[model samples]
Target: MLLDRHRSLLFVVDVQQRLLPAMGGGEGCVARIGLLLEGARILDVPVMASEQYPKGLGPTVPPLRERLGNAPVFEKITFSCARDETIRTAVLGTGRRQLVLCGIEAHVCVLQTALDFAAEGLDVSVVADAVDSRRASSRELALARLRQAGVRVVDSEMVLFEWLERAGTDEFRAVSKLVR
Candidate 1:
């Protein structure tokens, strides 16, 4: 299914300072997420973020935190954001059932969160290139698990274009530049 900007919420999970540097290709993952964030902003998609034990992991990385602006950032100790009452409430509060997710530690927080949300009957898509683990094997395994369990494993471009839906407009123009 195509991603509808109005019906979607971009959920960034644990792309924290200390956590990011530990992931393989961490910088590249963050760059891909940056594209998602820019596209989401241009398309007016609602955004929400989560920090897994921020006291330990540190807050969302500076680049992403700046882009988050006034968007809600939930702090949770649960591996699955869906398992955290406050985060779950805030996510449901947006009234958006489709979640576009990007973050670190794919086999842990990202994997668990996608599984939980998918089980709850929400449409969930995890941006593969925008999520990472300390090891490539773990990331791949998590992605395989996610797909087997019915969550869509997508790339950043797929999301941006899906959200854009068409060409020749201002939103498309703005988002397209991000891709380039």
Candidate 2:
């Protein structure tokens, strides 16, 4: 299904300073996520972020934190954001059924969160290129498991374009420049 900007919310999960260095292709993942955030802003999609165990993991990386603007940031120890009451309420409160997720540790937090949201009947999509684990093998396994369970696995570009839905407008122009 095409992503509808009006019906979508971007959920950035645990792209913390301390955790990011452990991710495979971590820098590239952050870059893609940055693109997603920029596109989301241009398209007027609401954004929410999570920091897993912030005391230990530190805050979201400076680049992302700066871009996050006023987006709500939830702190949680739960691997699945859907399992965390506050995060879940904030997400559900948006009334957005389509969730675009990106962040670290694909095999754990990202994977579990996707599964839980999908099971709860949310239309969940994980941006594959924007999420990673310390091991490529683990990321691959997580993506495989997500697909097997019927969560849509997509890339950042797919999300940006889908949200844009057409070309030639100001939103399109701004979002296009982001991926360039």
Candidate 3:
């Protein structure tokens, strides 16, 4: 299904500072998510972020935090962000049907959160290039399970272009520069 920008909101999962150095391709994942954030801003798609146990995991990394601005940031101990009251309320409050996901530890928090969102009847899509785990095998397994469970796995560019819908516009030119 084509993701409608009006129906979409970006959910940045626990891309924390302490966890990233051990995660495979974590830096690359951050870069990809940053691009998505910029595109989301240009498209006017609302964004919400979650930080898992910030005291232990640290904050949502410097780069992403800067982009977040005044966007709501939830702090939770739950593996499934959907279970966190603040996050659940914020997500439901948006009224956006399509939830585009990006963050760290694809096998754990990201995986559980996607499943919970799907079960809640929201259309869920995880940005494949913007998520990762400490081990590649774990990441692969999580993604395999995610597909089996009905969540759409997509890349950041696919989402950005879908949101843009066409080229030659001012917004397109701005968003296209992100990928380049």
Quote each prediction's TM-score. 0.98, 0.99, 0.98
Worst 10 residues of 1 by lDDT: 171-180
Write candidate 2's Cα lDDT for 11-118 as tens digits: 999999999998879999999999999888888899999999999999999999998999999999999999999999999899999999999889999999999998
Error of 3 at 158 (Å): 0.3
Q: Quote the positional error of residue 145 for candidate 3 in Å.
A: 0.6
Provide the global lDDT of candidate 3 against the true structure: 0.93
Lowest summed lDDT window (length 10), candidate 3 = 85-94
In model 3, what is the error at residue 90, expressed in angstroms? Answer: 1.0
Residue-wise C-alpha lDDT for candidate 3, range 61-146, written one tens digit per residue: 99999998888989999999999988998898889999999997899999999999999999999999999999999999999999
> Per-residue lDDT for 28-58 in model 1, tens only?
9999988898888888999999999999889
1 against 2, candidate with superior TM-score: 2
User: What TM-score quantifies how close candidate 3 is to the native fold?
Assistant: 0.98
lDDT measured at residue 156 in model 1 versus the true structure, 0 to 100: 96
Best by lDDT, which number? Answer: 2
Per-prediction backbone clash count: 0, 0, 0
Ranking by TM-score: 2, 3, 1
Colliding pairs, model 1: none
Collision pairs in model 2? none
